[model samples]
Target: MKLLVCIKQVPDLESRFKANAEGVWYNEADLAFRMNEYDEYAVEQSVQLREKLGEGTELTVLSIGPDRVVEAIKKALAMGCDTAVHVQDAAASGKDPWQIASIIAAYAKDKSFDIIFTGMQSQDRGSAQVGVTVAELLGFACTTTIVGFEYDNGTITAKRELEGGIKGIVRMKSPALVTCQLGLNIPRYPTLPNIMKAKKKEIIAIPVADLLREESLAATTSFHPPAKKGGGIVLEGDMADLVDKVIAILKDKTAVLR
Candidate 1:
């Protein structure tokens, strides 16, 4: 069995954020980067599948981003992926989901992978479109937000989480894609030996320009922080008086009450 897991490097959420000078995305200076949390589960699940399927199973992880993404790829390699492919783009932040998915699909179009795994969404963009778009571009059966997975006899069964605490099950044959959600599996920390081994693993670097088929379909025209909220007002009084005050404030401040 051949498996490919797509991962991404994202800004650590706790880092402070400010718009770049171009006003297209966040400034990267002094920011810490890490692998997207959801992609960790995808990588772990792929590694587990490879382990269960035996030594002959070849697992390759892929990521598209600037050179810094090598850090993320190395983590995946240490987690048991056999090799990695890095699609390097210095301006990766400028690309939209469609462009990103197109590059991935182009790379995998001829790889003949039996299964492709990806996180349900990225932490930075959170568009939640790239995985399914790749599946569509490759003409593979696809399921998203899967929290449980099983494979046997050349078929995959997935448990998908739905709205209102509902769960949906899906079964598909080989040559499929799955976007993993949280609670799918616990990600393992890379051991010291594995980290050393990962340093020697193969990482094929390809320029993003070679894989890109066309220009980005969408562009960000404006990017800014949300408006600051005003200070809160506290009202302490009897229930009837509080209700009257609330109504008066609403009538004075908002068109809805008026």
Candidate 2:
């Protein structure tokens, strides 16, 4: 079995961040970058499948970004990925999901992978569009927000987590794409030995411009932090008074008398 897992490098939001002078991007010089949390689940699922499938299974971790992004790939290597491919582009700062998926599909189209996996969405943009778009580009069966998976009889079954506590089940043959959700699996931490081994693993670098057919990048218009919310108003009164307060508070939202 051959699997390709897509990973991403995103800002570690626990650390402080500031916008660049142009206000179009973050100041990477002061930021600590880490693997996108959602991608970790994708990587873990790949690793788990390898363990189950046994010998002759190859797993390749792929990411597109600047040099710093290689660290995220190395982390995947330490977690048991066979090797990695890094699509390097100094100008790929803010490409939209479609352009990013197109780049991946362009290179991956020739790879003949049995399955491709990626996080449900990136942490920075959270557009949640790339995985499905890549599948569309590659002409593969695709599913998103997958929390469960099983492989049998040359078919893969996926359980998708949906809103309102429901699961959407899907079954597709090989040469498919899946966007993994958080509950898919627990990502393993890299042991010291594996970390050392990862340093020697191959990380092939391909220029993103080489894989890209055209410059279909997105331009950011503005950057502004979310508006601060005001403190909540607490109601401290009898049930009747509280009901009256609630009715008054919701009056503007009411479309009809009740």
Candidate 3:
């Protein structure tokens, strides 16, 4: 069995971000980047699947991004993926959800795989569109936020999370897409031996133009950071005075008291 898992490199979530003078996004230049938190879970799931399917099974990690993203691909390999494909294109930095999905789907269409897995969403965009959109483009059955999955006798069963305190159990055949959530499993750290072995593994880099001809996307308006917040005021008075002040402030701020 062969599995393909899409991985992404994202800015650290806690970093302070800003826009440059050219109206482009920028982060703290010295801050570190890591694999998308959810993608790490996806990679771990794929590695587990490979282990279950035996040494014959192959797991491939794919990513679309600039050269710096190789670190993320290597990380996946160290986590147990057999190989990786990285698309180097500066344009990927501005990729919208649709464009990203299209590129991944287009490239993956040619690959022969029984299953494709992805993280529930990328941390940077948090759009949660890529997995579903890629599945649609590839004409595959998809299950998202999958907490549990099992394969037996050519059938795959999955447990999905739903809103409003509902859970869904779905069954499907081979050739499916599953977007893994964090709760699916704790991602394994790359051991020193695994990291050493991963360095010798082959990483294939594909030119972005060869995958998809054009962007097919545009950013209508530039993004900007919100203005810094003003200082806060604390109440300091007797109990009754504090109560009166709180009530007055609430009345001033809200229409409910009116």
The best candidate in terms of lDDT: 1
TM-score of each: 0.89, 0.86, 0.85
Stretches of model 2 off by over 4 angstroms after superposition:
229-258
Q: Score each candidate by Cα lDDT.
A: 0.95, 0.89, 0.87
lDDT of candidate model 3 versus the reference = 0.87
Q: State the lDDT of candidate 1 residue by residue for 137-170, as single tens digits.
A: 9999999999999999789999999999899999
Instruction: Give the CA lDDT, 0 to 100, for residue 174 in model 2.
Output: 83
Best by TM-score: 1
Summing lDDT over every window of 10 consecutive residues in candidate 2, give the lowest-scoring window: 214-223
Clashes of each: 0, 0, 0
Q: How high a TM-score does candidate 1 get?
A: 0.89
Alpha carbon deviation, residue 5, candidate 3 (Å): 0.5
**How big is the positional error of residue 231 in model 3, measured in Å on the Cα after superposition?**
8.5
Which residues of candidate 1, in runs, are more than 4 Å off? 229-258
Q: Report the lDDT tens digits of candidate 2 across residue range 182-226.
A: 979889999999999999999999999888885555678766676
lDDT of 3 by residue, 1-258 (tens): 889999889889888777655565664376688999999989999899898888778899999888889999999999999999998877676767888888888888888788899999988778899999989999988989998888875578999988875779999987899999878888999999999999999999889888774455657367577766868677896999999998998899989885
